[model samples]
Target: MELSVEQAAELRELVNSRDVPADIATRGRIVLWSGKGRRRKDIAELLGVSLPTVDRWKARYAERGLAGLEGERPGGAREQMPARVRSRVIALTRMTPPAGTGLSHWSTRELAKYLARTENIVVSWHYIARIWREESLKPHRSGTFKISKDPAFAEKAADVIGLYLAPPGGAVVLSIDEKTQIQALDRTQPVLPVAFAATGKRTADYVRHGTTNLFAALNVTTGEVLGECRPTRNGKDFLTFLKKAVKPHAGKDIHVVLDNLSTHTTWEVKEWLSKNPHVHFHFTPVGSSWLNQIEIWFGILTRQSIRRGTFSSVHVLVKQIRDYINSWNTTAKPFTWTATAGEVLAKARLVATNMKKIVNNNSN
Candidate 1:
């Protein structure tokens, strides 16, 4: 297709610019000479270049148009397997490997070997790597192994996401999750509080004093976080923390979304939930922790505030966490959930179902 007006202007500017290399200028001149149907000898003499260079430019321009002039040669053999081969490769990758290989998915080397041995195709590891990327397939990975075991996952996900989709007035929707075993470091040399002066200095070397757990509840509408430091992350400890944290906003029903941890749904927690009818629990799907917005907030807390702090004791650790929260509540803002329920459903349900059908569709 012909270049657009803007594109043509850009090309003209690029061609005239001082930064434009002589090779590119030569190619453009060659095209101009060819437009007049000039002989290679005449063109080479006019440009004061070799006849062979003129011939090479003419051949490249004839074969690949403007793309070849930019040093992108298109002379390599066409992909042997084609798009059909790539589709087959992805399908085979999802299948269980041969019995002895003891692998669930195919590695690049293993795939190359499989193709060479079984399909009579002389495939290379490099080719397999390129094709896999071209087809948007990655080698076996831990995080990529996701199985949707929750049958009622979609329905439950909708209900949970809907709370944030449009929350009730005067009632806050908090995405609550626990960051267990947060280590507290103690400086061997007592960290003298630095005064606001010309020489504001503090100690750096520190020692770790075991670990403490942080039970954090983040108000999705308002970015205010209420966090408590617990000795352990058991059900009783979580319940106690929740009781203390929820005291500030008691009258309204607190809809807390947490992961499906055993401690979160213990008998003690169940009993507490029964007594506190105003507090409701919504659990994320079995393997879908990414759905929790609190996880993202926790990551920020770890990265920005908590990672490089020295704490003398649990009390100091708790104080620091509280101080950070207080500072954050002043300026911290809640994250906007852009992925709507419909968009999530499309990705999780519709896309997954179609992918499965496509995987199983090939009549092999």
Candidate 2:
């Protein structure tokens, strides 16, 4: 068959393009080969399709052009799933399974089986899964939340956040915290180093040599950390670390943001604060230790240094921690806190309100 330039270009594109369906591309090839004076039988053999298949597509192209090559097969589209069935699938998915089923949440297969047995709504697990994906539902996953019960939550949070956003002139702002009971663990067998196409492996079992406590004071302005590995996390040890952290600042005023731990509020610490009038402590609200940015540094320390490290003794663990602290200070950057006090308080209030509504609904 003779072809126009436009038809030739479209056929070439359909044959070459990866996005075009395989069958459509094959059809394009058949039409192109036929236009090139190749025999229909040769085209069929080259494409590994029957001679009648090649003839059918060539007839389709001649009758309707490229439009006939695309779209659904000869028969009409499949029957639409009932709206009621989709609705029931979504509704059951949002709810917990019945008490005696021993299921905490609904899986696609389990949900399909339950619906078939109880509701007489027979459907495949794949069909139910499709509905979940369309609706963006994941019953298998869960998250955690906690609302601070401190009556002075707003005041304390505002105080700490204010320091982060805007610190007083000529005063040093530090976020201080203790990461307690860090274990010095050694794997039973030496870890296998990562190689090509393989991940590093370690024995599931470990020997615990001992534990150590790390007290860290993160300079909020410069991101430099003053950390010490102490044998204990008592008030005396915290006081010693605090003095070490404050030594470099000398005569300047120091503002410390820390959580409300018993060790932090000890009489010795109170006395030290009284004597060093330039040092001020702003405590985060109860159970809201996340407000302290030193916790962020602690997480980094755990992930990068301690979690994967092999330490035979507490001394080795302490040395590794100190080394990491030294390295971190060299390239340290301050963690930017963007959320304003009002924004944080607003979110907390919303969560509290939602919890209250849930509680009231349950009571009713």
TM-score of each: 0.53, 0.58
State residue 6's C-alpha deviation in candidate 1, in Å: 40
RMSD to the hidden true structure, all candidates = 17.5, 17.1
lDDT of 1 by residue, 1-364 (tens): 2332322322333333344465665565566455545677777765667888877876765665444566643787554665556665666565446546645356766786787788765655545555664565653532233334567778767877888788777776878888887878764442222321224332233566778788888888887888877778888887887787677888997888887888888899899889999888888776555567787777677656675466887778878888887888899788887777787777676646755776576544
Maximum-lDDT candidate: 2
* Cα lDDT over the full model 2: 0.78
lDDT of each: 0.66, 0.78
* lDDT tens digits by residue: candidate 2, 1-364: 8775546645655665545566677788789778868899888876678998988888888886765576465678644677767777776676546656766467777898898899888886646756775687766543112356678999999999999999999899999999999999885432121321163222223578999999999999999999988888899999999999999999999999998888999999999999999999999987577688998788778767886688999999999999999999899899899999999999888876765655455446
